[model samples]
Target: MTLSSNVIKQCALLSSLALFSLSSAMADDHTNKPVVEQLVDTLSTIAGPHPGIRKNHAKGIVVSGEFIPSPDAATVTNAVHFESPATPVTVRFSNTTGIPDIADNNPSSFPKGIAIRFHLQEDTYTDIVSISVSRFPVATPEDFLGLLNAVATSGPDAATPKPITQFLASHPAAKTFVETPKPAPVSFATQPFYGVNAFKFTNKDGEVRYGRYQIIPVNGQEYLTDEQRAAAGKDYLFEELPRRLQQSQVEFALGLQIADKDDALNDPTVVWPETRQIIKLGTISLDTVDDNGKQFAKQTMFNPLALTDGIEASDDPILLARPSAYAISFGRRISGQ
Candidate 1:
């Protein structure tokens, strides 16, 4: 079944509260860090041409100057299946901060990332899962909104720091990431994609257990330093994604970890540690590349709420916020009523 609009708003509100609460408690901890330095390092490492908003650029991909869907999938670990959900997907490639026509490769903005996803799945997992390229994910949902608004309003001087700084001062949750998030990887092939949500692993008998999904990348991650990225140009992430596709097959193995249901629910901030073991489930391989157009390349909306059967969402606030945010942005783009 499709997600309801009411649910989406609630998720955003709850995430806002959670992140705000986290930030309020850390004033002393992050007071020493410079917000500008943090933003510089934080935004520069995003991977792809689009950062926060999915602007409907699903035309396809371009590799080595050829257009296609990124052809390096066959060798991707656990990438055993290939099927399109066929749900209409809109991909927008742009930045979380900066005006509509601004170049995302600017060192001052966040790097690119894809939001590819399909509509609601039949008997799909109830638990939602959304992950950012960085470890802390984001400190608050309002921060996300700020990102969108920043990009929407960016102009000469590109001084996005003002609004964000004001927001951090007003919202405690925004303070949590004062140390700077690690940033999204420059190449999706190298970074591990996480299900990032706690789930219940059920048995045929209806037994249940807590779990997490891990998309293990075949390569190691590489990030852009603020200085290096500034000199690279606005389309750096876009250039990198296609560059890797031309070299070889790109693959990621999907794995799951069964953790304690109680602990899993209580601690959304901690990773359940790989020593607990992540069971391999499947793989996703994009066998071609296409730089044809922004519609084909960017705006592909991927929501953790858009799931298949056999998995589920936890009570985690962050996981729940994605479906709502994704739905709002997606619904606005599609059914433009």
Candidate 2:
């Protein structure tokens, strides 16, 4: 079953109020260190130390692909990839959490991730980072840190209505996120990924629009039934992607969910109505698995803010802070910290 729209909106309101009340207090505590460092520290605290891999979404598989833009793609943005011929891409599919060896079917892996790197001319490139869920829990970097800290502090015998539970109580979106049932996908090729932040797209004509990304599998979204999930192996998702690629190329349609003038552009916690327009951008066809998928993923930093001409980052604080956070994680793994 899915949550009703009314419930989600109400929760978003409650979350906003709760966050507003706690903002001043949190401001004092987070000043001693950079928010990015705090972010890294909180994530490590929650997931424990796992050197040489991503701090989050550590278990992932990388694949090589090319993106073929739709003719109408140029109508939305003047971005090179949208107007040029087929562009080469490096795509990675990953599980949630920092445990590199987490089981494919683990509940913690519900919100699977996909990060795509669009290789443009002159060695420049852009990236899109997304997850299975359409909406994120918090809207700001500080709130995200608070969420992480709450989870990290909440332990077995911590207390009734633990820190995490109390934190979720005040944040409706986070509550909804935690309560949502996310089943395991039969294969990475069968799931859909949605962008968490909105971007401002400018066309050659200088017209601008705000939109979020949506990458849907050409095969459509398919999840394993309870019976199938129970019988699946620990490495099912990772193993299945390679086997599926050998059978045929894995394909997905890249789309943009255009927002109306009144839509909240900066807040990721708000889920736009389903009736909004979704503009088809292109098709992504992945054929080969990276020879050193793990090492390649560790070395690559898929920054959502690493955009090219014609695409600009919105004023979303979470969106703006991502590049710095990712840089810290990349540095740690690259230097073998």
Candidate 3:
């Protein structure tokens, strides 16, 4: 069934209510903040305050590029970026959290982010926001917020049985997310980024397929050794990317990991099996790092839900909540709040 945008929004609201109900029952005096507000607040607590900026993924470098579609791209989807002559693109590579100067080797910097804006016709655009991790820690927005709350409440001086430890005990996927090795990348261009949420793609024949986006670096993956990590500069990624670009363009192939009939469509925390077929859609060629591109990236807000025809959001609550949360971040940043 074709899911409408309104249906996705309602699902997100319902998920929020479910989360609030469960958490409120556990606590005597739970704050009645909106889901978006709670998300911002919890992330702010974890990442510390960064006024007039994103609560997470605040540190980034923007670059300009082009998206060259593969010949068979149209057979899988009719997304505008895959149709043609090369389309201009703007992208941001960011570290996790609000600390703009977090060390490149910090474990907190795992699941690095890549946000892409495909400049389509008529000044319209589509965004694909992804992270280095294949799976997310929580399946729903409620669980995500709960995890953050657990972290916030379980500080160094908290009572016996820390909240985070309790949280991890209950959420195995979250525990796995924490336990997973997230090695520092040699460069942003070398890391494989995955869209943890699934999206529906429609082809010219009107056939719909549910899949996750996997952006594979054309240059192959490379990671820093333990010794290299120990001696790396705090801003190593930011410093390395531009120098790498000066030598040659950075590129990655945009591929979709097609979901099986029995795959969990609504859970971002569950990764689809690698046995599924992958369809290469296009190539992202990042050629230049300029002040203009940087300014544009800073001003632009990339939303995964900002989709065009033939491309639609799945029922994933995390995916549904993103647009609203992004709007809040964008508004705060632009207004200098």
Collision count for each candidate, in order? 56, 0, 0
Off by over 4 Å in 3: 1-29
Model 2 over residues 1-337: C-alpha lDDT tens digits? 0124323432443344333333323334526666666787788777788888788898899999899999989999999999989999999999988888889988877699999989888766788999999988898887888898888888897988899989999999889888767888889999999997999999999999999999999988899999999889989999999999999999999999999999999999988998999999999999999897776676577878778999999998888777766666666776676
RMSD of each: 10.6, 9.4, 5.8
Against the true structure, candidate 1 reaches a TM-score of: 0.55
* Candidate 3 residue-wise lDDT, 21-75, digit = tens: 3343221147665666677678888887777777788888998889999987898
Number of residue pairs clashing in candidate 1, backbone atoms closer than 3 angstroms, sequence gap of 3 or more or interchain: 56
Residue 292 Cα positional deviation in candidate 2, in Å, after optimal superposition: 2.2
TM-score of 2: 0.91
lDDT of 1 by residue, 42-61 (tens): 33322224334333222223
In candidate 3, position 323 carries an lDDT of 69
Error of 3 at 24 (Å): 15
Instruction: State how far residue 176 of model 1 sits from its true place (Å).
Output: 3.4
List per-prediction Cα lDDT, in the order shown.
Answer: 0.43, 0.84, 0.82
Residue pairs in collision within model 3: none
